[model samples]
Target chain A: MTVSPTRIPEATVARLPVYLRALNSLLDSDVRSCSSEELATAAGVNSAKLRKDLSHLGSYGTRGVGYDVEYLRYQISREIGLTQDWPVVIVGIGNLGHALANYSGFSSRGFRTVALLDADDSRTGELVAGLKIRSFDELTAIVHEHGVAIGVIATPAAAAQAVADQMVSAGIRSILNFAPMVLSVPDGVDVRMVDLSSELQILAYHEQRKSTLQPDDGVVA
Target chain B: MTVSPTRIPEATVARLPVYLRALNSLLDSDVRSCSSEELATAAGVNSAKLRKDLSHLGSYGTRGVGYDVEYLRYQISREIGLTQDWPVVIVGIGNLGHALANYSGFSSRGFRTVALLDADDSRTGELVAGLKIRSFDELTAIVHEHGVAIGVIATPAAAAQAVADQMVSAGIRSILNFAPMVLSVPDGVDVRMVDLSSELQILAYHEQRKSTLQPDDGVVA
Candidate 1:
């Protein structure tokens, strides 16, 4: 079944992968089918929200028997476009880039790190995750050779915008940026940033609230 | 002035950091004051939402003159508890852990990585980002000595739960998980997960939609 992008909300689209992961775990554990509540708990979401999200993809579970684990997995995977492999390139082989290159979850979810490119001449020819690091100048050539449409920027904040400019010029349509900086890309190019510091800051805000509310109930012993 | 957590919505709390970051950038560039619209654009948010968010913190921009950049920065930093240093311990010193230790953003904010713990004996005594990787058995001692309340779990999915359990037992109330698995933490403890593959999958979903909608409008060269 083909699903149109307009039919699903962006928030629902983001949660689709979480649901897919939970479904995959169920399938791995030999679970043939699961109710909406069961799937929601597995996905770390509430049942009502899970049902509403699945309804966007036309995946309402059976009234009593619930959802077929394998069928649901395939549907979610196809919806997230994981059914086809996506050639991805990492620009900047720093510590963060090294971690991204070594991440095994990428391959399982249809992302293949076709090339690891770095601007530093010293890092060139170095091997990470069995792949040789290439020069940043080779970006265009490598993108063309591998049909890489997604580029991951793990460079420092100072170099992020420049790297993004290079990626855009090289025709990368999607970018996953790890740099803690704002990147200005062309209109058509999509950029999603994962700011480790921002995540920690948010947690600190809540943690601060918790401490203030219960000063005597200190956890730090 | 201390702002009560109950006064602000969770969504507003999440966006406060973005606003603070934008203000800091303006401060760095010597922009003393900015209208809500200008600050909103800098933060990649809309003016109405920005105004509403800041209102929760009792930070209303002066009529025409706009907000005092330094004042807003101080308010946000204080509200998010960045004024105080939070001792943090990272468990599992692998590549991702290495990236976390090397991350300069943590120290710039409120988090300080006081110790790095690993279960493997081989990784112990090794230095990462100038800090020695200590044995996992030293977790309690380090947490107590450093007054660590935040724990980062960068271990593999197989070991995330065990690491989280140890962190909880060692008095860590906040956790930033990088493992690609669901971690079951007890009540009152907050967990924020950063799944790299999940983020990529979301991007792939949008990318797939773009390609399908305009099959001949290939950006890849």
Candidate 2:
């Protein structure tokens, strides 16, 4: 049966992935039910916040009881469109691209890396974690054959835009960009950046502030 | 003179890195001062939210006059511990680590990838992005000599834990992990993970939802 759009908030949508991971971990342990507090604790979030997040998915838990681990997992998974497999293409077989190619998380969910493409002829025939690097010319054919809608750009900053342009032309509408540059995608396409140093800089900012605001903690450590 | 303590919320602390990056861009363009509205917009955040975030660092901006671009930049840089360079050790000389070693952001942010350590001796003599790879056994000595407090674990999931364990023994307390596995760090140490596929999976969830909800948005091409 088809499901209607529930109009979940962006904030709630972002947290769904976290909850889903936690649920899967719990399921691995054979957990049948989990209270909001329990699941939230395991997920490294507050119970109140966890319940509020789940409320966006139309109240899957009871007031007195908690939630069935598998049921909630299924609900969130379906809502996230993970019930079906998503074939993906990776452009730029550099260091970051190699890591993405060998990444276990992609294969964990229904996401699969259908092809690995690189413009460099030297890397084209090299084997990376079992997948032989292919040339960028095969992007369109591969995407059409694999029905790839998700494209990952792990190329260097200089080549990011070119890869993104080619991806869009090949009917790739969703892009996960690792290049430390701002990508301007068209209206229908979506781009998400995972900047490594940026995340560390953020942590450093907090650590810096913590050193000042809580002198005792820093000194003792 | 030593700096006094100042309190900053965890959420605000996280966004400080983003603000710093945006401000640096503005500075490179020779922009002097910016209102919360302008700065927030450039940083992909709202004015009110940005103001609230800045407020945590104690009224750095004038109520009506906005913030001095250079002063705020310094404040944020200092807050993120960039006033002093942090020496980091990368345990993997693979593709992602190589990109990071050559990345301009780290060199600019007072962070140096002091040494590249790998488990394989054959990968040892090879130079990547200018730095030569060394054995993982060198992690402790290099950390001690360079006073490295932050370490990056870019090895495969199977080897990430051993690398982290060695880092801790070397007195490194902050870690930026790019491995896909869940890391269990000892108390008092902080670990941050960047999973490429997880980010894509998250974006895919949103992209799939968007396509299903707005099927009327035809392929313009």
Candidate 3:
């Protein structure tokens, strides 16, 4: 029921949410139990890997009866600290920022966007997902007011690092960056980069390999 | 110079793009040469891991003199197949899709958005990123006309699986999915998920640990 955060491997920590999502879908369908193979299929991972990842949190499915879906879901959620409310601030109100503001998953998963901050003065007072956009200058006040611990940066590359520096100064520890730049933060501050361009390039890398291997195939009209 | 795709590990394949980005930044600054330590810092990896990864591609930097920035950049680019053009299709013209269409990284890094498709008829005439939105029915024709091998699904969760199925049927072998759902695909098709909510959850997990470890340390005024 209790596992220290340090005990779980980083890769396993990343997949915890995926397992949580799979368990949520199972719960919605009124499924009370599931075998490791079934859960693994839902999570898009091999059953052996899934079992190993779950073992880190002391969750082992029964020999023949499998896991109790709701129980496992709660255990994983608690281990991931989803049981507590996490106040967040999103900076930069560009297209990606709009998408993040409208994302319903955050609210459903214990994250509440306390403020949407943008450096542009014109963006202030604009409404997004029921929260009014505020100026970036107000970040310190907003973070203090809402006790925001996590920040999201959807700014362009040129402005990402400055925004991250401000977030750190404002006492924000976790950053979910959408910019296509590498951000440097002090140790203990976690920065997760969701580079859209890099992801596409990765897919392109594999696609190229496939085409080279079968140069004559799929020559469509 | 020709290394088979199967020879590279999946983790290394993902990091290659990051290395390419770092090298690009160096190239922009007229950095003709760099030590492994410097390149690894820019790429946000340790020098040992960077050296090991580059070794897999038969690239071993000269002792003391380090690597030629341009040469290493080209090598990584060629290895990742960034020298070629890759046509891509984006399905769903919502906020996230609009963001993807406007994203400059894709076009700059070998991915060309051939078409934008939407299920709603009303979105057909709307122009996004200089390309007019088209009906989802035109997917097959667009895929064939452009020989698009990669697809991006930004539709809502309920529609993501159907869109993926359509992409697969239309001959798309790789998919970058933004919808918050588990997509089931056939053997040959590759699916990469960019779940925004899940990313936030991971950050929250770490943030929670940070707060618990230092409770009452930052009770800001």
Report lDDT (CA) for all predictions.
0.88, 0.78, 0.89
C-alpha DockQ of every model: 0.56, 0.41, 0.54
Candidate 2 chain B lDDT trough over 10 residues, lowest sum: B1-10
Which residue ranges in model 3 land beyond 4 Å of their true spot?
Answer: A1-6, A214-221, B1-6, B214-221
Q: Which CAPRI category fits model 3?
A: medium
Instruction: Give the clash count for each candidate.
Output: 0, 4, 0
Residue B120, model 1, lDDT: 97
The candidate scoring highest on DockQ is: 1
Which 10 consecutive positions of candidate 1 chain B have the poorest summed lDDT? B212-221
Candidate number with greatest lDDT: 3
Cα error of candidate 3 at position B67, Å = 1.4
Model 1 chain A lowest lDDT segment of ten: A212-221
What digit string (tens of lDDT, one per residue) describes model 3 on residues A58-122?
88888999999999999889988889998989999988899989988889999988999999999
- TM-score, candidate 1, chain B alone: 0.92
